[model samples]
Target: MLASFRERFSMLAAVLALGVLVGSPDARAETLVIAGDPWCPVNCEADSQRPGIFVELARDIFGEAGIQVEYRVVNWARALHDARKGRIDAVIGAARNDAPDFLFTVTPVSHSRMCFFTRSNSRWRFTAVSDLGGQRLGAVKDYSYGSVLDAYLLSHAEDPTRVQLAHGDRAFALNVDKLLNQRIDVVMANAWVMENWLREQGLGGQLRNVGCRTPDLPIYLAFSPALASSPAHVELFEAGLRRYRADGRLQRLLQRYGVSEP
Candidate 1:
């Protein structure tokens, strides 16, 4: 009986190894729920025909590893909160420091160039965090402008009068309106997001960048600790990313959405 049991265990182990090697779906499907901040051209609401570049890229990468990826466009703040609380599996189109505790994949999924926007006639440039003191600034609620800007927001918690945090689908238009009316000195947003929205709104010719641009930060796929993923899940996803890039899938996907090489 002992020898029979040993034989059965050995056979089971061999079968399991073969299943993994052959890309079998013997393992349960792990649905990696990723949240995006509805940034146009890169990541936007899922309803958009071009549901952002990261959407397709992430889906294919994880699919290769037999892991399912479900994307949802939600308020950026809610996305972060959900990920932090382990209610979601991951967040895409995220900066390196956006969620420091999450496990970041090896390669960056994309890049975001952030800057300040103002009326063409205004001179409210964001040279430093201190420069924002006592100035009217319009920013999206729950968004981060790197460490410097984030720190400024934290330190000035007592004086919330300077920043107007908009929370609506028309947030971009609201910021533009405030700036054009001199209600706000400057508005902050991702450069790509600003350009896309401006073009969509036909206000591209009116607004100008203050050029206090954050160097294009590499965006990544970060997994939450509460994610029901194997310890090797991150590694597998990274490998898939590498393979996708090597075979030129990433570039093709970008081109498919009319995005140019950065």
Candidate 2:
């Protein structure tokens, strides 16, 4: 009886030791939380099977290194704020000027040219800053439209006739609604993002890009500056991005989203 009890105890201890050696399934994979507004083809719907290009890229790259990406949709301002406070991992589809304090990968994931959109028949085209004098401009809050436009927007922000900023995760869509309803004369957004949006919504015939004055700016997968792991995350992204570029995965992914390579 004593010998049988000793054998059973040894077997139980061995099983427990093996379990400790293996660890829990949850312990095997690290979770990375990323959040941003829905800037389609860049980062789209949350909990979607086809979350945007960057979201997929992050999952693909980080998954190889035992990391899982959790994407969420938050308003741009909140996303930026959370990232700054170390409450999140990264913010997708950000221009450097958009969050200069955030940590960034060495290479840009894409490029953006901010442009003004008008009704297909509107004679108002943005030729100079003077052209903005009489037009009501609709823009997403917390977005940077470069120095010249930013300055103009700041000076006129209080006047509804001059500038109206949309807030919320769906701010871009709201701006589009305002434009289509003639509540605003012009809408400002990234040229490629807006083009994709119009094409996807079948509203291309309703709106047209008047002009783009701001230089094409590089966009990044900006990581939290406050996180201790941010630097490593940035490095991982930089290396993986280089590999993707070399292997043509980047081009293929961009094609899937109907976007050109940066």
Query: Considering every candidate listed, which one attains the maximal TM-score?
Result: 2
Give me the candidate number with maximum lDDT. 2
Clashing pairs for model 2 are none
Tens digit per residue, CA lDDT, model 2, 1-262: 6754653454344334323434643322557889899988788888788799999999887775566889999999999999999999999888887899999988998787778899999998997778998999999888877778889988999999999999997899999999999999999888767888998898879998898875677888999999766766776677677778867999999988887853
* Span of ten consecutive residues with least summed lDDT in model 2: 11-20
- In model 2, which runs have C-alpha deviations exceeding 4 angstroms? 1-28
What lDDT is reached at residue 57 by model 1? Answer: 79
Q: What lDDT does each candidate get? A: 0.71, 0.83
Q: Write the per-residue lDDT of candidate 1 for residues 1-262, one digit (tens) a residue.
A: 6754653454345334434644673643456688866787777768767778888877776565455778887766777778878888777677767777778877887777778888898766777777777787888766666887877666664455777777665576687788889888888887777888888878867899886655667777777766545235566566666666777888898778666544
How far does residue 60 in candidate 1 sit from its true spot (Å)? Answer: 1.5
TM-scores across all candidates?
0.79, 0.86
Candidate 1 Cα outliers beyond 4 Å, as residue runs:
1-30, 167-174, 260-262
